[model samples]
Target: MQTSPQAIFFDVNETLLDLQPVKESVAAALGGSKELVPLWFTTLLQYSLVSTVGGRYADFGSIATAALQMVARQQGMEFSEAAAKAAVKPVRSLPPHPEVPAALERLNAAGFLLYTLTNSAADALEDQMTHSGLKGYFAGRLSVDGVQKFKPHRDVYTWAAEQVGADPKDCLLVAAHGWDVAGAGWAGMQTAFIARPGQVTYPLADAPDHTFPDLDRLADALTMR
Candidate 1:
């Protein structure tokens, strides 16, 4: 049986914040068609995985830019340095999902220590959190920039746990991505899957300890458990 968390670590992008604006922005920058949104996102994840396997590391933004260029080339679209940079502008200003603030407030009131772990840069994380009025709720924000590895990597979770001075088993990782949840589970942390629509779960090597339709449900489950 999983122990209740002493600290809950959340994934930034789709878990608590909506990335639709970022998707729309990128689509506009790519000539006003939203068709390439999935391609761009997939490319971003691909490069991050490749870099880790090849023992190389790039910041998320750098990888994002490179991936955009690659996707543009495949679509026979001309890539402009300016447009590529603009495509990522939304990352710095994404709004939190509707339930994020309320759920986070409830968690805080319930006395659960909270932290964020993301593939984004520390500054990017800070900007989003501050913009969403959630800066005060987090005890800390952790970025994978230093390690250059992405989710499903044991080292990143290990590093995050160490940074917060918590045992891996004592942390509950709440994320919308199955890979993030799998990674945390493999690292020995209990996992909660915030099942945002259009995302799917896989029969990965490690699986989440719990799954909920949204943050509000997750909060209620945590309270009950």
Candidate 2:
């Protein structure tokens, strides 16, 4: 069993905040059904991995735009820059999922330091967090821009650990993405997987320390730890 951590670093996007609005926006922009949103999201992540492997980096928004265009092209639809921009706009306005606020409050009341680590640009992350009523819960927001790399990268996790002045072993990385948790675990940090539906688990080589269905469960487990 692991000891209670001094700090908890969370992943934004689908982890705490619901992406349904953004998904709906993308569907409307693409003239496709809402089901297509997951397809677009998957494509976006695939490109991020490709860019990382190729030693190239693009901001998350830029990547989202490109991925949208590609998804449009795949559907034999001409991409609309305006629609693409509109599709991504909801990202900055997404609200937290039902369990987020209460879970955050619980963790905060327990005296755990909370922070955010996201692939989003700082400006965008600030807007999203502030609008979601979750702004005050975090000590700071750590964007991938600082490291010029995306999640699953060791440097990004290490950078976050250093930023908050916490030891990797004493910090618990919490994210809905298995890859994010796996990467943090690989970086020597404890990890909790927030198992959002439809997301895949990472390979065993990159598995997280624990998996919970949502933030509430994670908070409860942390308290017990």
Candidate 3:
């Protein structure tokens, strides 16, 4: 991101918190196979985009539940709501990625207001951060549920800026997801993409001003003052 952003918005799920446990849980629940996990996640994101473009609204957890069930049916696997909840239970108690804390501290110390913006349900987000001992780092958190639109939609990024009391231009979005960065960049916010292993940016999207393999490096690059 550019120097001195007035506020920084973070994408929560795989960006700050680790989701491997949830993936593992889902994989185990689905006949001890891991292949369906990726498909389910990808489908979840696609369905989220569908809801956003269709102008329909659903909480993230609800959408996730439905998506899981749909995937299970397609795979001819039995997945009850109870089972699905069990599989996804790890989300509430996920640990932060190893590089996250120090990076956040650097940004906080550099005098940037920090906030979380995620597709997760608002209440679930609070629980996730509190459970992971990361609740205090951010000044605030917002959710797609609030606007009934998902990230990569210009409305979400611009609305997030308004919530943080800054123009989109003065806000920088930090995320591991290419689509999130692309959306924020298109919304006129500076964006930095954290290239977590196994993740890639949308190739057709605008190039981010900064790309780091991890948060610690990103912190060093942007907040070295």
- Name every residue pair that clashes in candidate 1: none
Clash counts for all predictions: 0, 0, 0
Candidate 3 global lDDT: 0.87
Candidate 3 per-residue lDDT over residues 1-225, each given as its tens digit? 555788889999999999988998888877777989998898889999999888898888877777888888998877688788778778878899998998888878887788999999988998999988888889998888788898889999988998888999899899999888989998999998999888888888889878989889878877765
TM-score for all predictions? 0.95, 0.94, 0.96
Any runs in candidate 1 off by more than 4 Å, and if so which? none
Task: State the lDDT of candidate 1 residue by residue for 1-225, as single tens digits.
Answer: 288788898999999899999999889877887999889999999889898888888788888988888888888887776779788878878889999899998988888899999998877888888887888999988888756788769999998889889899998999998888888888989889889998766695555778889999888987776
**Quality of model 2 by C-alpha lDDT:** 0.86
- lDDT, candidate 2, at 197: 91
Ordered from best to worst TM-score, the candidate numbers read 3, 1, 2
Once superposed on the true structure, which residue ranges of model 3 sit more than 4 Å away at CA? none
Model 1's alpha-carbon lDDT is: 0.86
Candidate 1 vs candidate 3: which has greater lDDT?
A: 3
Which candidate leads the pack in TM-score?
3
Question: What's the true lDDT of residue 205 in model 3?
Answer: 86
Give residue 37's lDDT in candidate 1 (0 to 100): 88
Poorly placed runs, candidate 2 (over 4 Å): none
